[model samples]
Target: MGKKAAMQKSKQWNVKGAMRLTSVFHFLQSCGSGCLVPFLTLYFRHLGLTATMTGIIMASKHLLTLVWRPVSSILARQYDKRRTVIVGSLLSSALVVLILLLFPSAGTKAESGRCNASQPSADFTDGSDFTTLESMIIPSQSNVTVYSVNHTTVIMEQPDDLNSTYTPTLVNSSSNWSRRAIRYLRELKEQQEESLHTEFLGSLKAMDAQHQMFFLVLIVIGLWEFMAAPLEWTADDGLYEYLDFVDATDRHKGVTVWKPLGTAVGNGVVGILVTSLYCRTGTVAEFYSYTAFMILTVPTAALLPLYIRKRDRPTSGGFKALQLVHRNSQALLCAITVVLTGIASSAVSDFLLWHMQDHNATEIHMGISLALAHLSQAGFPLYAGHLAGFLKYHGWLLVLAVIALSIQCLYYSFLWDPWSIIPAQILAGFSTGALWWSVAAQCEDIATPGTEETLIRLFEGLPLELGSGLGSLMAGFVMQKFGIKILFQGISVILAVWSITLAALKWKIPRQRRINYSRLLTADTGEISESESDQEKDWLETAMEDDNQKNNWTIAKS
Candidate 1:
């Protein structure tokens, strides 16, 4: 998630102010996102949302990406409104957090699963107290008697408080003692029955209250996500636009590194604050910190680039991208890989916290866990190009991602304590970034000359979102029905099978290396030039053919 991805690096921006402002912008974005995103499931649990409900809410982030990203991109391109979109999104999203904090239904309430014993009512008259021989059977429940004495039973329930006193019916000279006992027993029965009814009604009301807040949060958070969606790609698009304008496109990593750095720092700091301040579930600290960081992001948002990159020709359409994937085997593999990877990653992101929480994990631990994942994920892609270029590790990346995710699933399947889980969190971004790298590299290598843009759109866009949304839904039900351990174990098995299948595919249909094997092997700086990689592919192929021919000749002579 921390990875700004395989998009081209922007040229360096020489202006000091622009660089400073963009750095600050990236920092705040990461800080705000990292501080609270990992703990959101815990927040929902504190608010009494069911596991399935939380899944739907988390899944909305991905599914809704389908709707908002294009809208943001179109507006940014057609109207040159990147600044407007990012600022508006931050403010609107901040407002949504504020609303959730203030909304009463969103606050903590009595759990419906709690057990509350109803009080017992009893009364004894003081006037003319001569009645005696009033034998009582076992205390009655719901007006049913366990024993009777002389065709009458005077059963009295004890109060919950042990200090409360009960008056015994003494011997009576009055003939109406039986009538009095009967009357008093009837009153006690009626009172107990009334109390039971009241409790039943109260429970129903509490359940209604739980459901009311659940739906309210669902709608509000969905809207919040919809508003916030543009902040991801739209803001970067603007920054890259400015970089293109100033011929600083190569400085993309320099400007974008702030997001992951800030996010990592924010997570660690906020987690500590939550721990020290006792900002437990249903608390205000997480939301407050998020709102503050987002508010800080506003000033930086003002200076970001908003100009659209002017294209002289029309790019390939979305439909054309699908047509390419349909015809190309590697492209088809990329699409499937992204989708399945999205599903596994989504399930882990959405519900693994719930699993940790079950083992007594707190916000701080989750924060650090997420911080580690972000740092690890962010670092990989820096060298991913070299690895893919030098060894042509595209197919192997898929294998690594699948196996990494499978290992993660297995680790989580045996999750005992939350602290031990942090180490496993490192795999979180590795698995995702590996798959993204593999798919992106494959799409780039296999695309038709003019259809590169469309091909990129196909693998990165809808398939990931659709898979994420679907995974969340299915995992949610599995978690609620069986348990977290079983759910992850099942996912691990499925991934194991998929990994084997992919291994077989890689064996059967090997992809040609896109980079020159000899040059990268010899470069001292260890820097990979993609341009060089592209130019020398034909040369590498010719050498391979010549070697193969020589091997055949040698074998024939021998």
Candidate 2:
């Protein structure tokens, strides 16, 4: 009896130790990822990659999540190297990023900085475009405004709609130009920033080096992203499983909260660092901080348990989850809503920072806004139950999420100043939090006996990733062709329409609540129900285990 008590004490100690270690690892990894991810668009832009190319790369990363996580899960279970994989991924990613920093093409945009000058023409009365930041340095002497950055001359093409395009080009100083005297129409440069000799799209000949560099970057970053998603999945799953085995699932919330706290802190700090570096020497701080944070994470990750915690019950595969969804009309409706939500979610993720910067948001402002985004949903989780009860069903809550997304999109469309982004991010975070719970609870409701994890995965995994990837690609093309404002405005309209349709469908479909068999997750393969009326009811229903019971698995960081 004394030995048994000692064993119990030791197990208790292990649970406490695991929680502490898990929290530290989560914080460190999240901090590193926070610094790394939100600014990828900025880095890609700096590399002179077109918006379309950048979009493709971002989309590829999201899509790769489905492939990488399953493979890593297999490796982890087979090899029993969860800790090794996590630490190794952190180290390997740092190395890849450092090597990527050595590329020379990121400097090309800064080499000949381009801005569309509204005042270049004498007839243009409005200087509203230059209200805050000036990407263009208008020469005091020359009537002909060729684009220049640091006195380097660049070829310019005037667009019929300047708002539609922003191809950064620089102007040459008047003294460096050997100009033949034109007797007529010398005032053309003053009237327009376009050159008649050049095409509206400009020459693609010079972008060869940039294109090659971007392709290489695309390949490298895609691989990096492929490795990245799995590590996060492994880490989070490992922690949850650890907590489950120890019967310490109650501590899950306390531990996972650190991720957002770390994200908020790291994002804000890195933004300041980037701004400081950019002001002094025009450097991107994410390159340095990202590597450092990853390295810092190595020790923390190493301390996390290397072993996988085996669950007692057998869970159904994704096939059974799909079968359930096919049988249930409300589940089908909710699944469709999740996909549309994912697509809308991608627009803000890929381009909000870019949009903020376009309107003169400094790195600090963008960072704070992003940090706020992580924390915005923090309080919402507390009210998850209340919100669902008040709305009377998870389906309505999901419809509300779609509506929240639309409202956020509309806000983003009208945003002009940097400070306004904070509230916008807050709204995004809350809506996303609402969406996660609503989906999780609803998915749980529709899941029959065996399809718990599969149902959540169906709602949360590849479908969402697929939607986000496609959305990123679409956003890039739209923003590139029409401008960021138009992109947001159009998306807002689409979301608004979807939200209305979703609400109507949800209203028509009655909510169904399955008995909470998952809560009885136990080691008994003897019977799913310690007591149940029908055996056929439980034939499809087995103990799915605590792992599948995890709600809030989707869009936790939105």
- Candidate 1 differs from the real structure by a C-alpha RMSD in angstroms, to one decimal, of 12.2
The residue pairs in collision within model 2 are 114-168, 114-169, 146-171, 147-170, 147-171, 148-170, 148-171, 158-194, 449-541
Q: Which ten residues in a row have the lowest lDDT in candidate 1?
A: 114-123
Task: Evaluate model 2: give its TM-score.
Answer: 0.73
- The TM-score values for the models, in the order shown, are 0.70, 0.73
Which residues of candidate 1, in runs, are more than 4 Å off? Answer: 1-20, 103-207, 245-250, 253-256, 279-282, 309-324, 382-392, 447-458, 510-558
Per-candidate count of clashing residue pairs (backbone under 3 Å) = 17, 9
lDDT of each: 0.69, 0.69
Q: Candidate 2's residue-wise lDDT over 394-476, tens digit each?
A: 57777778888888888998887989876778886557877877777777666554455457767767668878888898988
lDDT of 1 by residue, 1-558 (tens): 334433223223444556777788889988988777767777787777777888888777678887778677766666767778889998988878667665553433433322222212112322323232322421234222222334433344355666986543433323486456556666765576567656854433333445666767778888888888888678766666566677675675576567777888888988888777662333577788888899999988987755566663353356666765675566666677678877877888888877776777776777788788778776778888777677556667888888888998889888788889876778856686677667767766655444554566567678888888888888888889998888888888988898898878877764544445465465521243424344355556778899999999999999
